[model samples]
Target: MSSSSKIRVIVVDDSALVRSLLAEIINRQPDMQCIGTANDPLVAREMIREMNPDVITLDVEMPRMDGIDFLGRLMRLRPMPVVMISTLTERGAEVTMRALELGAVDFVAKPRVGLASGLNELAAQIVDKIRVAAVAQVRRAPAASAGAIVHPHAGGAAAAAPVAASPLLGRLSTEKLVAIGASTGGTEAIREVLVHLPADAPAIVITQHMPPGFTTSFAARLNSLCQITVKEAVQGERILPGHAYIAPGGRQFALAKSGANYVAVVDDGPPVNRHKPSVEVLFKSVAAHVGRNAVGIMLTGMGADGAAAMREMKDAGSYNYVQDEASCIVFGMPREAIAHGAADEVLPLAQIAPALVARLRGAGDRVHHRI
Candidate 1:
C-alpha cells in the first residue's frame, strides 16, 4: 500500500523488546505502517503531536504515567484510536475496562514471561487488534454542556401528564431471555449494554471470547456493579429470571430445554470461529432450543463468528438485533449479520437494551412510535 493508504501507528511501551516486536508485527502487515515508538506517556504525547498517527498501541504499565491516566488526557485533548496492551491478570482486566471507559478503543492481553509459550499467542492477538483498531472510529468525549436537560413536568400541569409517561419509561419482562455473543472489544462493549439494563431485565446468557479463569472474575465484577444477578454458567444449571449467565471460557455453553425451563449445557468442543467458546456455537443452541422465545443479540467484534448462527435464530422467528457500525469498535460481526438480512434491527449501544425490553413485551408498535 502507498504511504497515504497505510494505517500509520505509534507503539508506546516501556519495554524495548515489546516495542520492537510490536513494530515488527505491525510493519509486516500490508496495510499498516509504524510511524514511531514511545517509551512513556510524556514521549507518547510529543510523538502524537509530531507523528499524527492514525492509531496507537499503548502499554497499560509505563514509567512516567500509567496508561489509564494518559488515555483520559489523550481523549480530552487529541482523540485517536488506542489499543491497550495489558497483562492477563484480574487487576489488568479491571484497568483495561477503565481504559475503555476513558476512550481507548480496545485491549490485548500481554503475554506472560515464558519463551515459546506466551509470545506466539500474544503476537497473534496484538496483530489482530491493531488491524481492527485502524478501522475503528475514535470519537472525542462529548462536552458536558452540549445538551440541555428538560425538567419533567416543570413547565405546568399539562406538561406533567405527558412527562409522567415518558416514552423511555417501559417495563422489562423476565419471561423472555436474551442470549448474546461477541468477541474482540466485547468486554467493554458488553459492560456498557448490561450496566444500563434495569433490575428486572430479561435473563441474559453471554458467550464472549475469553479464556479460562477470566469469565468468573468478569462475571463476579459485573454482578457486584449491576442490579441483576450475573455469574459464570455451569453445566446442567437452569436459566432463571432476573439473572445473567456468562459461559465459562474455554468451554462451549449450549441451551437445552428441560421440561418448562432452560438449562445450560457445558461441553468441551472443537473451536468454532477459531474460538473454543464460540458465539456461533451458543447462538445455534439457543436457536434450536428456544426458537421464537429467545432474543438474540450480536455485539461489536471481529470476524463473522456469530452472524450465521444469529441468522439461524432469525429464521426460527426469534427477535434479533445487531450493534450499529458507528458504535462498534469493530463492525465485523454485526455488519455481517445486517448484510445477511438476519437482524430485525440495528441499534446503537444506548438503544439496544430498551429495544430489547420492548420486543420482549410485544410492545414493538409502541417502540416504533419513537423511531
Candidate 2:
C-alpha cells in the first residue's frame, strides 16, 4: 500500500532512545509506518503540519512546551489520534487523564528505565496503541466561530445530549441497574457517560481494568463531578438506587441476591480474560441475580472479556448496549460483543450516557412495544 493508505505515525519524545525504539516498532508493522520524529512540541508542531501523520505517540514530559499543552492546541487546531506515553506513577496517571480529556485517544505506560521486562511490556503496549490509534475516529475540534468554550459543564452537556437520543432510549422497561465494563481508554469514556446522568439515575456497577490504588481515586473523582453517588464496591454492600459501585481492582466483583436486595461480593479468584475485575464475572452475576432487571454496557477497551457475559445477560432478557466502532478508542471489546450478538444497540460514545439513563427511565418501553 502507498504511504497515504498506510497508518502513518509521528513519534515525539525528548528521549532519543525511546523515540528510536518506538519508530522501529511502528515501522516493523506492515500496516503502520513511522513518518518522522520530533524532539519536542515545538518541532512536533512543525512536523505535524508537514507530515500530517494519522497518529502520534507523545511523551508526557518535554521542555519548552509540555505534552499536555501541545495536545490541547493540536486537538483544537487539527485533531488526530494521539497516544500519550507516560510513566506509571500518580503524577503520570493524573497527566494521562488530562490528556484524555483533551481528546487523546489512549495512553501507554513508559517502561521503567533499566528493566528489560518493563521495556518489553512497553513495546507491546506501544504496538497495540498504534494499531488502535490508526482506526480511531479523530473528532474535529469545534471551530472557534462555533463559540465553543471549554467550560466543563457545557462540555459535559454537549457530550451528553446525543446519548439521550440513542435508539436504546426507547427500548427499556423498569428502572434497573446498569453494569459497564472497560479498560485502557475507559476513564475518560466512563466520565463522559456518567457526567450526563441525572441525579436520580438508576444504580450502576462498573468494572474498569485498573490496578488496586487507581480505582479508588477514579471513583472519588467521578463522585465529585457527577450528580449520582459513585464509590468503590465492597463485599456485602447493598446495591442502592441511583448510586454507582465500581469494583476494586485486583479482585473479582459479583452481584448476588441477599433476601430482597442485591449485594456486592468481592472475592479472590483467577483472572478472567487476563483481567482481575473481569466484565464477564460481573455480567454473569448480573445475569443470574438481576435477570431482566439490568442493563449491560460494554465500552471501549481491548479483549473479548465481556462478550460471553453480555450474551448471557441478553439471553436472560436484559437490555445491552455497546459503544460503536466509530466512537471507541479501542474497538476490541465492543466489536466482540456485537459480533457475538450480545449487544442490543450500538451507539456512539457521545450518546451512550444519556441513552443509558433514558433506557433506565422507561424510554425503552417504545422499543419493546414496537417489537
lDDT winner: 2
Candidate 2 local distance difference test against the native = 0.79
What tens digits encode model 2's per-residue C-alpha lDDT throughout 207-317?
A: 988755567767887887777789999999998766899999789999988887789999988899878989999999999988788888998888899899999999998
Against the true structure, candidate 1 reaches a TM-score of 0.84
User: Per-residue lDDT for 230-349 in model 1, tens only?
Assistant: 999989988887689998988998888889788988999889989879999999988888887788889888888888899999998788989988777778899998887889989976
RMSD after CA superposition, every candidate: 6.6, 5.3
Candidate 2: Cα lDDT at 56: 95
Report lDDT per candidate: 0.76, 0.79
What local lDDT score does residue 20 receive in model 2, on the 0 to 100 scale? 79
Superposed model 1: Cα runs more than 4 Å off: 115-117, 142-175, 363-371
Per-residue error at 284 for model 1, in Å? Answer: 0.4
| Model 2 ranges off by over 4 Å | 1-6, 28-30, 111-117, 143-157, 160-175, 183-185, 211-213, 249-251, 363-371
Whole-structure CA lDDT of model 1: 0.76
Candidate 1 C-alpha error for residue 32, in Å: 2.1
